[model samples]
Target chain A: MTITLNNRIETFSPQEMSITQIMDEKSFHFKMLIVKLNGTLIPRESWPLTVVRDGDRLDIIHLVSGG
Target chain B: MTIIQNITSHLSVKKAGIAGAGGLGSNVAAALVRSGVGHLVIADYDIVTKPNLNRQFFFADQEGQSKVDALRENLLHINPKADVEAHFCKITALNAGSLFGSCDVVIEAFDCADEKKWFAEWMIAHYPAKPLIMGSGIAGYGSPETLRVQRSGNLYICGDQRETNEKLVPLLAPRVIMVAMMQADLALELLLQEKPL
Candidate 1:
C-alpha cells in the first residue's frame, strides 16, 4: 500500500495499518504531537484504533520550545 | 488623506489578542501598537528574567516584573492612546476563546508545541470565523531565506517549517524577531481587510 506522510509518498508492506503502527515505524516519539489523517484530527487516545489505508495523508506535527 | 491619517484610520480601531508574551508575543504586540492598533489583549503568566533581555521587548529594570505588566507599559509608551489589556496568566484551551473572543485577530505565539496545538485546535473549533496567525520552527541564526508564509483555511503560519529545538540551535534575536515581524505584518494585512472606506 502507498500512503502520503507529511506530503511525501511512501510505500508500506501492509495494505492497511493502525495509526499506532505508523507512528512506531516513523519513530515519532514526541509527546507533543498533532496527528491528522486526511485532514481530520485523530485524538491521541484513538491512535491505536485508528486505521490508515492507501492514499491516506498523515500530518504529524511536533511542538518545539522557544518563544 | 495624509499617511499618518491613513494608517491611523485603517488600524487604530482594530483589536488584537496575542497569546504568549515572550519573545514572539511581546515583539508582535509592540509592532502592532506602534502601527496604530487601537486595542490589544495580551496574556502571559511569566515574569521577566535575566535571560529574557537577550531578545524580548524588556529592559534590565523590568526583571522580576510580570511579563504582561511590562509589555503593557512598553506598548503604552509607544502609543499612549492605545488601549492595552494585560492578562498575567497562562492561556489554555478553556480560557483562550473567552480571553480573545472579541478581538479582530488572535496571534498564537506560544513556545510549546502542545500549547500551540491546543490553542490552534480550540480556535478552529470555537472561532472558525476568526483568523489565527501562528509561528513554528523559528530557531537559530539561520538565513532569512528559510522563512516563508503558509496558509490553510483561515490559519496563516509563518516560519521556516523546520522544528529546531533550543538544544540544537539557540533562539537568537534576529530569527525570532523576523518571524514575529512576519506574524505582525500578516495580522496587519488581515486587519486592513476590515477597514472601512
Candidate 2:
C-alpha cells in the first residue's frame, strides 16, 4: 500500500495498518507525538485501534525531548 | 474584530503563556519580550540552581530564587514595558486552562519527556484552536542542524525530535537557546499571522 506519511510517499505491505503498527515500522519512538490521520487528531489510546488504508494521509508529528 | 497596525504595535497588544521557566521558558520569554510581546504569563514550580545556570536565563546569584520570579525579573530587564504574570506553580491539565486559556499562544517547555507527552495530548485536546508551541529535544551541544520544527494543525513541536531526555543527554546553552528562540519566533509568527519559520 502507498500513503502520504509526513508529506512523503511511503509504501508498505499488508495494504492497511494501525497507527501503532505504522509508527513501529517507521521506528518513530518519540513519546510526544501529534498523531493525525487525514487531518483528524488521534488520541494515544486510539493508536492501536486507528487504522489507515491506501492513499490515507497519516501525519505523526514528533515533539522532541531533552529540554 | 481585527485592527490594521504595524507588527510592533500588534505585538504590543498580544500575549503569550509559557509553561516552564527553566531553559526553554526562560529563554523563550526573553526572546518574546525582546521581540515586543506585550504580556507573558509564565508558570513553573522549579527553583533556579547552579546546574540550571548552564542554560537557563537566571544568574548565579539567583540560584535559590524561584524560577518564575527570577524569570519575570529577567524578562522585564529585557523589556521594561512588557507585562509579565509569573506563577510559581506546576502546570497541569487542570490548571492549564486557567493559566494559558486567554493567551494568544501557549508554550510547553517542560523538562521531562513524560510531561511533554502528557501535555501535548492535553493541549491538543483542550485547546484545539489555540497555537501551542512545544519543545521536545533540546539537549547536547553538537548537531545544531538536527533541530527542526514540526507542525500539525495548531500544534507546533520544535527540536531535534530525537534526543534522549535532558537527564540522559545533558542540556547545554547553545542548542537549548536555539530551540527556545525558534519556539519564540514561531509564537511571533503565529501572533502576526505570518508563515511558520
Candidate 3:
C-alpha cells in the first residue's frame, strides 16, 4: 500500500498511515497531535479516527521544550 | 477607539480565559479586567519569589504570595467589578480542556517555547473553535517597538524575535513588559472584534 507523508505521497507497507499511526511511528509520547490535513486541523480527540489518504496534505505541528 | 467604548457599554459581557499568571499573564489579566472584560479565568501554579520582582510587577507587600493570588489581587484593584477565577496549578494536558473550555479564547503566556508548544498543541487539538494567542522569541532584551503579531488562521503569536544564540540581559525588564503589553492588546482586539492590522 502507499500513503503520503506531509505532501509527498510515498509507498508504504500495509500498516495504517493515519494520524494515529504516524504519531505512533514517530514515537510521539506527547498526549496530543496537532495535525492539519488539507487546511483542517484534526482535533486531538479525533486524531485516532482520522484516516490519512493518498496525497493528503498534512502538517504535523508538535510541541517542543525550548526557552 | 470605539472598541474601548463598546467594551464599557458591554460591561456585563465576559471576554476570555488566560492560561498563565506570571509576568505576561498577570499584565493581560489586568488590562482585560480594567477594560471591563467582565470575567477572567487565570491559571498559574507558581509563587512570587524574590527573583521575580525585577520583571514581575509585584508590590513589596506581595513578595511571599502565590503568583495566582498576587496577580488576582492586582487585577481586582484595576476593576473591582470584574469577576476573576484563579487556579493555582500548572496548566497541562489533563486540565487544559476543562480549564479553558468556557472561554472564547486562551492565551499561552509562558515564555518557554516548549511550554508554549505543549499548550498550543493541546488547545488547537481539543478546542479548535477557541483561538490560541501566545508570545515567543522576545529574548536578548530587544527594542519594545520590535514587538509584532503573526497569525496562522486562528492561531496568533505576538512577540519580538531575536537570535537564539545571543546573550540577553540577565533579566530584561523593558522587552518583557513590551511583549506582554502587545499580547494584551492583541487579546483585547480579538475579544472586541476591533479593526485589526
Candidate 4:
C-alpha cells in the first residue's frame, strides 16, 4: 500500500486504515481537515487510515489567518 | 445577567497579575481595580512620556512618573480597598514566574507579540491552572466588532487580525480601552466561576 502525507500530516500513516479509526485511537486534537485523493478533494471528515491505492494525490488543507 | 451584589466578594479572594504597564496594561489595571479585583500585581519598566498621555489615563502632572507608580496611584484612587502591588522592573522570563505565582489570572497586555508569546507560554507551562489572556491584531481604527475571541485550552487571545496601521487608525484610546475592558471582564468571569462574558 502506497501512502502520502502532506501539510501537517507527516505523522499520520497513509496505509489502509479508516479515518474514523485513526482519529478514534490516535489524534483528536485536530479541528480542521480536507483530505485529497487522486486530485479530488475529499470531505472534511472522510479521510481514513485505510490503505492508499496507487496514483493517489493527497492534499491536506487547514485554516490560515490573514490573506 | 448575574449582578454581583457584593462586588468585593470574589474580588477579595483572587489576585490578578498584569504585565506591560503601558497603554493596554494601564487600562487593564485600572479596570481590574474599578471592578474590585482583590489583589493586583503590576510590573512595568517604563516611564510616562508626553505621547503616552494621548491614550493612557495617567495625569499630565505625572509626565516623569514611573508607569508602575502612576498606575498604582490611579488604581488605588479608583478602589482603595484593593491591594495594588507595583514592580518597577520589567516582566522578563526571569521574573515572570514569581510575579504571576499567586495570580489566578495573568493579563499579557504587552504591545509586542514576541513578549506576549513568551509570557503566555511561560504562564501556561508553569501555572497550568491559571489562565493566560493575550491581546493581538487590534491595530487599525476599524470595527470594534471585528474584535474576536480565540481560545485553545486555558490560553485565550483577542485583538485585531493584523498589525496596526499608524496612519489610518493606529489603535486609539477608545478602542484600546474597549478591548482592555473586555479582557479584564473575561478574566473576572473566569476567576469568579461565572459564565464567560
lDDT of 3 at B83: 82
- Tell me, by DockQ, which candidate is best: 2
List the candidate 3 regions with Cα displacement exceeding 4 Å: A1-67, B1-3, B163-169, B194-197
List model 2 lDDT by residue over B57-145, tens digit each.
99998989999999888888887888999999988877988999899999989887778878877877788799889897777878788
lDDT pick, better of 1 and 2: 1
Q: Model 2, DockQ value?
A: 0.64
Residue pairs with clashing backbones, model 2 = A64-B136, A64-B137, A65-B136, A65-B137
For each candidate, the alpha-carbon lDDT, in order, equals: 0.86, 0.85, 0.69, 0.67
How would the docking of model 1 be graded?
acceptable
* Residue-by-residue lDDT tens digits, candidate 1, B71-170: 9999888988899999999887678868999999999998887788888788877887789998887889857898877665567777876766567788
Name the regions of candidate 1 deviating beyond 4 angstroms: A1-62
Over B4-107, each residue of candidate 3 has an lDDT whose tens digit, in order, gives 57666664475578887766777777767776778888888878888677767677789889888898788878877778888998888888878889887787
What's the C-alpha lDDT at position B10 in model 1? 82
Residue B163 alpha-carbon offset, candidate 1, angstroms: 2.8
lDDT of 4 by residue, B6-59 (tens): 655657777998888876789888887777787999888889988888678799
For candidate 3, the per-residue lDDT at B57 reads 64
Candidate 3 CAPRI category = incorrect
Rank by TM-score, highest first: 2, 1, 3, 4
DockQ value for model 4: 0.05
Cα lDDT for residue B138, model 4? Answer: 56
DockQ of each: 0.37, 0.64, 0.14, 0.05
Pairwise lDDT winner, candidates 1 and 3? 1
